[model samples]
Target: MANTSSAKKMVRKIERRTAVNKARRSRVRTYLRKVEEAIAAGDSTGAQDALKVAQSEMQRAVGHGIFHKNMASRKMSRLSGRIKAIGA
Candidate 1:
């Protein structure tokens, strides 16, 4: 469907970027899930550690433009809050 050679190249670039973004997103989700699982298991220390890793991954996602800055901040805030509430 691309009419020009440049257009075809653009399509290829988009596909490559999409795959990279998808992998990044998946990695971020895995980090978040680890935190959630730790929280569910009531291991505050493990949850805290996982939350730290998740926060780092989320920030990386924002830096890479895979997620909005505020979105990542909000998620980190909520996850931290949950981590705090776990032992209280």
Candidate 2:
């Protein structure tokens, strides 16, 4: 379907980028899930630690353009809020 050489190259580039992005997304979600699990278990200390890691990973994803800046910020905000509520 790609009629030109450039288009074929672009398709290859896109495929590689998609795989990288998918991996990053999965990694970010794994970190988030860890935070959620810690919060759900009511382990404040564990949750705090996990949140720190998750926040870092999320910001990294944003930096890589895997997530929008505001989306990452919002997720971090909500997760932090839940962490705070765990102690209350």
Per-residue alpha-carbon lDDT of candidate 1 for residues 1-88, written as tens digits (9 for 90 to 100): 9999999999999999999999999999999999999989988999999988888889899999999999999988898898889989
Where is model 2 more than 4 Å wrong at Cα?
A: none
TM-score of each: 0.97, 0.97
| Model 1 alpha-carbon drift over 4 Å, by segment | none
Q: Give the per-residue lDDT of model 2 (tens digit) for 1-88.
A: 8989999999999999999999999999999999999998999999999989989998999999999999989888998898899899
Model 1 deviation from the true structure expressed as Cα RMSD, one decimal place: 0.6
RMSD of each: 0.6, 0.7
